[model samples]
Target: MPIQTSANSRLRQSVGSPFLASLVSFLVGVSTLLVATLLIDAHLPDLSLASGQPGWLLTGGFLGVVVLTGNIFLFPRLGSVQTVVLPITGQVLMGLLIDNFGWFDSPESPLSVARIFGALLLILGVLGVIGFLDALVRRTPVVGNSSDAGPQLWLWRIAGIIFGMCSASQTAINGRLGVVLDSAVAAALISFAVGVATLLLIILATRTPWQLKRIDDGPNPWWMWVGGFLGAAFVFGTAFLAPIIGTGLTVMVILLGMMAGSLAIDQFGLLGAYKKRATPIQLLGLALMVAGVAAIRLF
Candidate 1:
């Protein structure tokens, strides 16, 4: 629990600002990823792009910067539950739109009623996770984790929601980039490297102190050291799957995995996360989420 509690407080304080935290973390994450990418390329055959790749395809990395910063801003304002769920909902919706329209040179995957119903169920699950029903019963507002509440609360929430949409957009865009590069690993490498450069520029231009190593020294989880590896796996996996499965389906599958992971963390109070026992309401919500995923992808 110290790791979890310390992680949040340290991030806000040590990095000086949410903007710095986001950029610095992204810088660290991408730096870690760049090393991984190089190692993987050396170890594995055919990891690199075979031919010349387009210039525009590289924009996916910048979008990732946005995603990281948005999450950084949202966590303090929205708490863990909403931080994860709201973005997920927005991302799923964006993925659907991208697939249905064939945007970003993606293949068409038309929308259907089952997918819509599934999305609704997923939303229902989100409400349960946040204890929306519990709040209603208690006749109280759902308070976020923030110690301070004021006018900017709504602004942060709105910004958080917008960031969620950006994240979903990035997924789709990166998937297309993967297609262009002809190899997912190549796209992942480019994305991470680009993100690292962008963060580096921001740090210098804004005069943010180099706090990239700060996360490693505190009461942070050992996982914090491996955040880069975790992040690398995700970005690489997104590029790997997005084009092949389409972003909507890819995100649906990813959502299921995330739900399971989130449940485990919350159940065990992993990383010092707030301890919330899995009640029937939460279970039903999870079941609905799974069912919704099935409806969208399988039905």
Candidate 2:
């Protein structure tokens, strides 16, 4: 996951516009999947399966843009800790909702007292993992400016939460799409295709320039182009896993692994990330999250 994000970071740098960069990466990914599907003689997706309910598939692409754009806008304003942590809170909460209600034809993992406790612990763990708790203790902004003062800042924070909810809901919707299409890969590909179409419309509507000529800077590394493949893999994994594991568990496990990778990235300065050794509090946070997951799973 960190590798995927690092690739996205490099791609963002290579392409001046984040939206354009995402569109290009997703295009490469979907094209690759289409070719691979043909090569494998895999069952091509039945477009008819999507006839009655196109909105489910559209959620994946549309909400993805919301998240990408949300992160781009919120990170600077809310500080990295709040930006990352807040969305995670929303993801887990919304994921729990989906799981409890069995929304999107997903398996139900109804809420329980133990699960609620585990969730609270998980949120706290995330706060600690990102150093938000520590920063709050010191009365300092959490790892960025975070000084965007006003009622509007709260609005952006709420937007951040909504973006998080969008992510969790996207996973559930794509899972249902996968089931309907009878192919997780196909669902992921379709999701990426929709995202591409959506981005194109936004570009046209906003009068955003293509800026393709900027590639003249020089040939970008091959790894930078791998974002699309990584993205495809991620979407496919979530679509495949959500139905089997339940949305809440799926999101929890993903978050656990994501933060773990993030800590490694920070500690080792991997993928051009800033070098920062993991603090004891962060390690403790990871432990608490592990415990939280255990609590959720065991009960």
**Candidate 2 clashing pairs?**
none
Q: Model 1 Cα displacement at 291 (Å)?
A: 0.4
Q: Per-candidate TM vs. native?
A: 0.78, 0.91
Question: What tens digits encode model 1's per-residue C-alpha lDDT throughout 202-251?
Answer: 67887866554454566544444444455667877888888888888777
lDDT winner: 2
- Candidate 2 yields a Cα-based lDDT of 0.83
Q: On residues 1-299, what C-alpha lDDT tens digit does candidate 2 reach at each position?
A: 77788887778777777887888788887887787656653667778978887566657878887888889899888878778887998999999999999887788999999888888888888888888777777797655556767898889889889889999988998898888888888878788888888888877887766654335577776787788888888888898899888889888888888889989999999877899998888898888899888889899
- The CA lDDT at 80 in model 2 is 80
Candidate 2's C-alpha runs over 4 A off are: 39-41, 136-139, 143-148, 212-219
What is the alpha-carbon RMSD of candidate 1 to the true structure?
4.6
How many clashing residue pairs are found in candidate 2?
A: 0
